[model samples]
Target chain A: MKTYLLKWWQTIRISWSKYTAYRLNFFLQVVGPFLVFFFIKYNLWSSIYGEDTGQLIRGYNFDEMMQYHVWTLVISLLGQGYAAMNLSEDIRLGRISSYLIYPFEFWEFHTAGFLSFQILQIFVSSVTLGLAIFFGFLDLPSTMTLLHGFSFTFFMGFFWFTMQYFTGLLAFWLEETWIMRVLLSIVVSFLSGYIFPLELYPEWLVSGLKFTPFPYMSYFPAKIFMGVETNFMMGYAVLAFWMAVFAFVNHLIWKKGMRLYTAAGM
Target chain B: MSNKVIEVTNLTKQFKSYKKKPGIKGSIQSFFNREYTTKKAVHDFNLEINKGEIIGLLGPNGAGKTTLMKMFTGIIVPSAGELTINGHRPWERKKDFKKKIALVMGQKSQLWWDIPAMDSFLLLQKFYELSDQEFKTRLDYMAELLGVVDLLHVHVRKLSLGERMKMELMASLLHNPDVIFLDEPTIGLDLVAQENIREFVLDFHKKNGTTIIITSHYMADVQALCKRLVLIFDGTKAYDGPLEKFEKILGNEKTVSFSFSEEIGGCDFIDKYDAKWNECRNHVDIRVPEEELREVSKKILDLYPVIEFNTEKMPIERVMKTLMTNPEVLRQQRENLSS
Candidate 1:
């Protein structure tokens, strides 16, 4: 157990240093694109609500609607873009062979590396939030709301990471997974409420989506920060269930994938 | 470890792959009716590698040298037959089994590319659960031996290929594995760099008595490190014995060259010897059996005042070329091995 933790710690340190080696590239890849994306969403939301100060569409005043989008940006930065691409690339190129001979498992190494990247992004996300507050474009949530929302979003991050890993495991059979990545991006954006809020959808659709893991990804945590009505217990339960399901599926895929890898020299 | 560290019997690996037809219609047809072929990468291979021996795996491309190495290192599973390294089944991939061996492939890097080599070494230390003192001692010793102590702090991508390869060796050796597998370790290196790597490997082997299996296209690597050779062809073992035996088994033709002080007054000697003349009229080369070397030299000297004359075995490249292209000789050798 001590050795496991030590290896993971070293993985984090080494991976973080690797990611930060190109400081400019890190900012451009992580910060620049997301900032542009957020602005585009901001403009689209503004156009929808119009210039009126009293606009309240779907129980969200203009300020609250913009805040929802801001939180989506935060959640996207904190919880999305898992290590699927790198994982799939390694599998496809047979580079994973080099690591298979090592004492540690492949998934553990990648998970620790992904966690390291996300941990650094947490600091980046905080700075973005601080800048938003300073610009008078955002309001801080209450202490109780902050605690609940953070814990929810943190767990959701891991849930999303597992889902991404599940997608990456398809590379053992598929030569290229860019199509799957594209499909995943579209599904995540539409279902996770990154494109719009669950309230904007039909009542049946909203009820159905609540049963899925999507709302817990962007809507639940962002709502807590918006001081909107929320079912924290229900959110936690759904996220945990889906996380367990994904984890089980990821493990199955990993077992079968390793067999195929060893058999065929992938 | 016992003397017999590695044993294999009728080990085989066959890869199943589909052939893609060209064009859009063919692509659709392939999706519907893909034709799969099973190419045997390693076929009925058998060997026994003793401890503390350097064996060269020699073969043409696609002859399953790398496949066999991968099987030995536990990176790939054999489709059939039994294989044991240090009495452990390779496909089990036990952590203890892995701790006893290390593999280095010239085409692939195990080091983190963007980070300093030292950082990767530290991660490996943790992976192997090496104590801080043990890790530092091995790392320092290997780094100094390879003359790479200063390059360890530089990013791997920024270092030259030779420097990076040295670091790779250091990383693999830090835990002092009992077995090492090197696949094309000297590929794409200059003469000096290749010699340096070869010398380091020799020194390391002499000191530690580790069992090593290396595959290289460079004969110099084979000549410098390995006394025994295992030659495979067409996915099967063709010959396994001392390196010198390869010359006797494959072919026995020796080249005898003669350089004269002045051009021969007459060209009649060429007809008697069937010699090929160099562009300069003074030099001639004749191929003869090893037993006729003295007779051929005496005859040549009777005709001309030889400034210099020499007899040497055929170059390894020529032998390999003949072996790779001719199926008849390879089949005969395989039959010999079986018998």
Candidate 2:
């Protein structure tokens, strides 16, 4: 166990060095996208509730709407920020051959990389949250509510990781996987209420989406941060079940992909 | 215990690829209905390597040398057959099996490009479970031997190709693997760098008694290091034997070239030996049987003003060239010997 832990620790350390190798690229690639995205959402919401601070759209005043979007931004950075871009490229270019030869398993190395990225994301998200509070876009919630929101969001990160890994593993058959990732992002943005509050959607659509894991990913967690949703059990159970399902499916896909792996272009 | 370190039987690997025609029309048509073809990259290949042997795997491009290397290292699974290395099935990819082997490809860099090589070595130390002392001792030894100790802390992307290759060798050998597979380890490098790599490999092999399989297009590497050669032709073993025997595969004839002081007409005696003359007829190369080499050379010296005479420097090179151009020569020789 000691040796195994050492392996993970060393890999994480190496990953940190790699991530921070280029200071400018790291700054631009990580925080730049989130800032631009939040800026656009902030403008779009302001225009929709133009010149009227008292307007309420689906039980959300303009201030409430801005607060909700701020939480979504925070949730995005903390929960669904990790992408498997390098994973598919590694498989496509035959770089995974080295990992296969190493004593460390490929998934273990990548999981350690994810852990390292999550650590950095935590720092970035906190800074963003502080800036939001300073700008008066958000008020400090109770400590218990803050703790509960963070705990649930972190759990959602694993489910997002599993799904991204599934798409990344499709490199065995598809020459380019970025299109699939884009399609998945668009669908998730619409169904998980990242674009608008689920309360504004049709009743039938919201009820149907409850059967899926989409609501628990962004909507439920953001509501928790707003202190408007208290039913944490349902979100936890739904996310856990989907995580298990995706994990098992990823295991089977990896097995099938290994059989088809040619280690091309080495 | 058996002395053999690697054994294989009836190993085969087939690769399937779809064909697409040229232009947009062809692409659209193929998108609807594709034609797939399967080619055998390695077929019914069998080999047994003993401990402490450095064997050269020789073949032309696309002749299955890399495929065989991949199979031996478990980078890719074989379509069929059985293979074992160090008492472990490589494709199973057990932790113990991975710990006992290393593979280095000349066309690929396994070291993380963004970080210093020392960081990668540290990561590998943990993966291989090397003790702190063991790791330090091995790192120092290899660094001093390869003269790359100063570059250990520099990022790998900043290093030259030759320097990166040395670091690659150091990375793969840190664990003292029992078996090492080198796939074109000196593909593109200067003469001095190539010689340095070959010398380091020999020194490492001598000290550790590690079994090594190397595939290289440079005949010099084969002549300098390997005692035996395995030739692959179109997914089959064409020749497998000692280096000297492979050198004389075409025939047991010696090629001796003589340059005369002046442009002299060819003598009748030289014509009997099937001599090839230069434009001026002052220089000629003759092929003589092994038994008659001395007699023929003496006769030529007595007849003409021989300014300089020398035997072939690299016989294996000429043999490889001949076999590559006309593989039928080797086939005919085998048939004649069997008969």
Candidate 3:
């Protein structure tokens, strides 16, 4: 058990070194997206609200809408920041052959890498949250609310990771998986209310999303941070169910894919 | 008890690929109704390698050398038949099986390119569950032998190819595996680098008595290291024997080249020996039977103004070239011998 833990710890250390190898690139990759996305959303919403700061669209004034967007950015950085780009590339290029030869399993190495990336993402999200609070874009929530929001978002991160891993495993058959990832991101952004609050959508559409995991992914967590939604049991139960489903599906895909993997370009 | 580290019986691997034509029309057609073809990359191969033996696997390109190595190392599963390495079914990929074997591919870099090699080595040390003392001792010994202690801390991408290759060798050997598979470990390097790698491998194998299987297009690697040769042709074993026996496969004839001071007319005596003359007739190469080599050389010296004369240095190289150019010759020879 100790040796296994050491393997994981050592892999995580190596992954951190790889991630921070290029200081400039690391900085840009982590913080750049949050800034750019927040900037765009801030301007777009400001234009939509148009010289009427008192206008309320679905129980949110301009200030509250901006605060909600800020929380969405934080949730995104914390929960959905990791991607399986390297995993797919490794499969497509046959770089995973070395892992097969090692005593460590391939999934163990990649999960260790994800854990290291999560550490970096947590740091980045904390700084983003601090900035948003300092810039008056967000107000401080109660201690319990903060705890619930962070705990749920971190749980959602694992679900996101499993889904990405499923797509990455498709590299055994598909020539390119980035298109799938892009499509997933767009769908999540629209359905999870990352672009706009779910309250602004039609009642039927909001109710339909409640049956899926999309709302709990971003909208529910953002509401938690904003102190408007306090129901954590249903969100946890729904996310857990989806997570189990993805985990099982990802396992099946990996088993089938390994049989078809020719280790091309080795 | 018999001492065999690797055993195989009728092992085979087949690859399936879709045939697609060129241009947009072909692509559209392939997308709708693809024609899949199954190729037997390795077919009914059988071999038994004894412990602590170095075997050279020689074949032409696309002859399934890499595929065989991948299967041996458990990177890919075999389509059929049985194979066992170190008493474990390699394709099962048990942790104990993985720990007992190592594979190095010269065409690929296993080291993490973004970080220093030391970091990667440390990670491997943990993965292999090596004691700190053992890891350090092995690292120091390999670093001193390869003369790359200073380059270990540098990023792998920044190092020269030769330097990186040395690091790769060190990384693979850190676990002191029982069997090692080398797939062209010295390709695309300078002569000195190649010799260095060969020397290091010989030293390592001598000290450790590890079973090694190597594949290379450069016969120098084969000549310098392997005492046994296994030839593969079109995904099947063609020859398996001692190196000396393989060198004499075609015939026991020695190729002797001579250069005269001035052009001279070829005599019937020289023509009787299958002599090939240069344009000016001042240089000629003759094939002489082993028994008549001494008599023929003396006669040539006495008959012509022989400026320089020498026999071929590497007989296996010549044999390999002949076999690669006309593989049918080997098949014919095998048939004739069998008959």
- For every model shown, what is its TM-score relative to the native structure? 0.94, 0.96, 0.98
Cα lDDT tens digits, model 1, B227-261, are 89999987898878887777666656677788999
lDDT of 3 by residue, B1-339 (tens): 679999989999999999999999999999999999999999999999999999999999999899999999998999999999989998889999998899998999999999999999999999999999999999999999999999999999999999999999999999999999999999998999899999999999999999999999999999999999999988899999999999899999999999999987848898888999999999988999999999999998998899999998889999999999999989998998999
Candidate 1, TM-score of its B chain: 0.91
TM-score of 2: 0.96
Q: Which candidate has the top score in TM-score?
A: 3
Better of 1 and 2 by lDDT: 2
DockQ winner, 1 or 2: 2
lDDT of 1 at A207: 90
User: Which stretches of model 2 miss by more than 4 angstroms?
Assistant: B280-282, B294-309
Report the lDDT tens digits of candidate 3 across residue range A123-210. 8888888888887887788899999899999998988888888888889889688999899999999999998899979999999888
What TM-score does chain A of each model score against the native chain A?
0.93, 0.96, 0.96
lDDT per residue (tens digit) for residues B1-339 in model 2? 999999989999999988999999999988999999999999999999999999999999999999999999998999999999999989999999999999999999999999999999999999999999999999999999999999999999999999999999999999999999999999898888899899999999999999999999999899999999999998889999999999899889999999999987747888777899999999999988989999999988998999999999889999999999999999999999999
User: Considering DockQ, which of the candidate structures 2 and 3 is the better prediction for this target?
Assistant: 3
| Candidate 1 vs candidate 3, TM-score winner | 3
Ranking by DockQ: 3, 2, 1
